[model samples]
Every structure is written in structure tokens, then in C-alpha cells.
Target: MKIIEKMNIEKLNVIYQIFNEKDLLRKLSHQGIIKLHNFFQDENYVYLVTELANRGDLGFLIKNVSPLAINKSMIQFIIAELLMPLEYLHSIGVSHRDLKPENVFVTEEGHLKL
Candidate 1:
């Protein structure tokens, strides 16, 4: 497909995966990071609307790990920040079941909140 067509298909696929409103909410809520905006179905299709984070996931950052010198505190901060999602999910009775360096994400504020 052309680039534009491929992009549209991706968006549609995201919408189709939800199955329904309830499923979408449960799934997105469990994403541990991104904020879902809305999910709906109209006649022949389902749609999922969510806040788009251009920075991408933790997997990307980990793959691009920097070689520059860093302090121990920085490492500790990264670990804690990434673990917060796992902690919050578990507290809510949800287990990520797939916790790993790839499943984390760092937001733009340098807060490592995700």
C-alpha cells in the first residue's frame, strides 16, 4: 500500500481490535500509559480514539540506549519510573504478565512517569 494508505489501515486496525466499547476501555485502561479518548462503532466499522504520543514506547528508547556517561542515580530513576506502571496495574488487580525493558515508555517531561 502507499504510505498514506498504510497509515490509514493502521489506524483502522487499532479501531477494529477493540471489539466493542467495553472491551476498548478495559484494554486501553490496561495499556498502563497512553490515554484513550473514545471508542465507537458505526455500522460497518469500529473506531478507537486515543491521545497520540509521538515519542513512542520504552522499547524504542531501550533499543537506542545511549553510550554517554551517566550517574547511578539516573539508572535508579529509570528503573523506578518504569516500574511505576507495573505497580499501578498490580494495585488495580491487573498483572502486566509481559514486563520487560521493551514494555516500558518514557514521557517527554523527563519525569519517566510512564
Candidate 2:
């Protein structure tokens, strides 16, 4: 999937810093975090080509599906799946500054990626 992040020219330096740290970004790949495949920029936006989450994000999915629709096993699975990457990030002194259901995605295979 492709995502475009827009920022003012003043924030250009921030984007460059992020892109320049490709090794750090690659090291962050895990079960729960979205993998960064490639990145580029034009005049106004930074383009990221990343893995596709066919099931979309967790926030919108929860809105459309009732909580009761999910069984005990599924809840347990999601919690278990999310924990590893969360722990791994923290262990490496990284904090997910923006963590919300919107930032978590579900794969077609019933797994979660943050």
C-alpha cells in the first residue's frame, strides 16, 4: 500500500531525518508494526510504500462490527499479537508516540500490525 504524508516546508528537515535513518527503520520491523518498504518525496509530500493490510485499520473495523461478534479466542489472539512488538519497541528505547486503533491494522490472515 502507498501512503502520502504531507507537511509544511518548514518541517522538511524532519522528514529528511526520518528518511535518512533507513537502517533504524528497517530494524523496527516486527509482527505488530507496519513495515516500511520504500520512501520518496516530491515538492509537497512524502510517499511511503508499505505492506498492505487488507482488513484495514482496527478503529474502523470495530465501529462496523459489534464487540459481541468476536469470540474469546480472537480477543486473546489480538492481545497476544500486539504485545510482542510493543515490548520490543520499548526494549529498544522507542516509543510509539501515536498509538490508537487507527494506527493499528488487521491483516487478512487475522493478525494485527501497528
Candidate 3:
């Protein structure tokens, strides 16, 4: 069984927590770039959870557009659009030390901002 809890401790971070059973599962779930759900055990395993993106990441989107010979303006727009999320993540005190296309998440809604 898992418990869903909101851990908003400043020390942990803007969004930080110590997950238990359910909490650990949630951390393991695939969520936003910084949004992670995790679990762990001393003699066993450590569960790192997050919100999984069924739609996948921006890198995949760019790859799919590769063969299309996309336009400069369009590419610029996409770049700008993609950067929006990055800006938010940074503003929120999160840094993407390792940023890749697969690291990004596309939600069900058309909106794209972490």
C-alpha cells in the first residue's frame, strides 16, 4: 500500500520530503523533471519515484521533427516554448544539471511549463 502526501518543507526544498511506503512509491512515479517520487530501505532497495510522462520528453519531439526540415521561425518558437519550462524550473530553485530531451515531460494538457 502507498500513501500520497504533500511534503512542502522549506528545508527539503520548495518541494521536498521524506517518503514512507506510499510516499516512496509516488516519488518513483514519473512526474515533472524535478518532480520525483522515491522510496528506500537500508538492507534492501531505494525507490526513486516520479510522475511518468506518457507523452514522453521534448527531445523525442524534436527528433520526430528532425526529418521534416523544420523552419527557422518554427524551430525558434519551439525553442522558446521549451525554454519556458526550463525558466520556471530554475526560478523555482531547481537546476537541471543533466538536461536532455528525454528528461522533459509533456502533460496531457497542451500546456508545457514545469
Candidate 4:
């Protein structure tokens, strides 16, 4: 779960914008760009329930893994897997402004998930 606190006006505005973009978020989930399960709002905070990526984000793995162990075939596979979701998003007129290793999640089955 992700929590957003409403302590300042700027934060509030950003939260409002996120809430306003629910349609796009849902579409992203359908396209495998994100795993948004559900969202809720209340007087104090906004809660987001999403996929549990037990293997954590790509950045953490990259930082810890040995460079020599990442062979050519593995690199190709990761790129190819990531590209499908990106292409789908582009075809639907959506762009992920924050595409980075930290945003990509890995699954326990050794698969990459957006």
C-alpha cells in the first residue's frame, strides 16, 4: 500500500491531480504499464493498493548483482520484455514520463513487471 499525506496545499493539489487521472491509471494497469489494484481517499490521506513485488525494484537488483553475471542473453530478454508494455502504451497515446529502473518491479518468478 502507498500512502499520501495531505499536510500542505501543494501536496493536496498534486493528490487531486492524481485522483483526476484515475482513468489513465486504470488504462495503464490494463496495458501492464502499472499494477494498480485499487485506490481510496479519506479526510486525511489517499491509499493505493497495488501488486506485491516481492523481488523489489530493478535498481536494487542492479546495484547488488554482479555485472559479469548479466550475460548478453539476459540483457536482451529484459529489454524485450520491457519494450512490449512501452509499445502498447505508445499505441494508446500514453507516455510514461518516469521510466527508470526504480520504477520497474521484479517478480519472485524472475520476471520483470512494470
Task: Using TM-score as the measure, name the better of candidate 3 and candidate 4.
Answer: 4
Q: Candidate 2: global Cα-lDDT?
A: 0.75
lDDT score of residue 99 within candidate 3 = 67
lDDT of 2 by residue, 1-114 (tens): 544455653455465555645456667867777787887777776666668898988888878887797789867887888888889989988877778888888888868888
Clashing residue pairs in candidate 1 are 58-104
Residue-wise lDDT of candidate 3 within 36-76, one digit each (tens)? 44544343333445455556566766677666567887668
| For every candidate, C-alpha RMSD to the true structure in Å | 6.4, 2.9, 9.3, 2.6
Quote each prediction's TM-score: 0.53, 0.77, 0.45, 0.78
Question: Ranking under lDDT, best-scoring first?
Answer: 2, 4, 1, 3
TM-score of 3: 0.45
lDDT of each: 0.53, 0.75, 0.49, 0.75
C-alpha displacement of 25 in model 1, angstroms?
Answer: 4.8
To one decimal, what is the Cα RMSD in angstroms of model 2 from the true structure?
2.9
lDDT of 4 by residue, 1-114 (tens): 557776653555675566755557665754345577898878877777777778888889988899997889989988987898888878888787778998888877777777
lDDT per residue as tens, model 1, 36-103: 56655555544555555455566676567684635587789877776776677667675555566554
Q: Give the number of the best model, judged by TM-score.
A: 4
Whole-model lDDT, model 4? 0.75
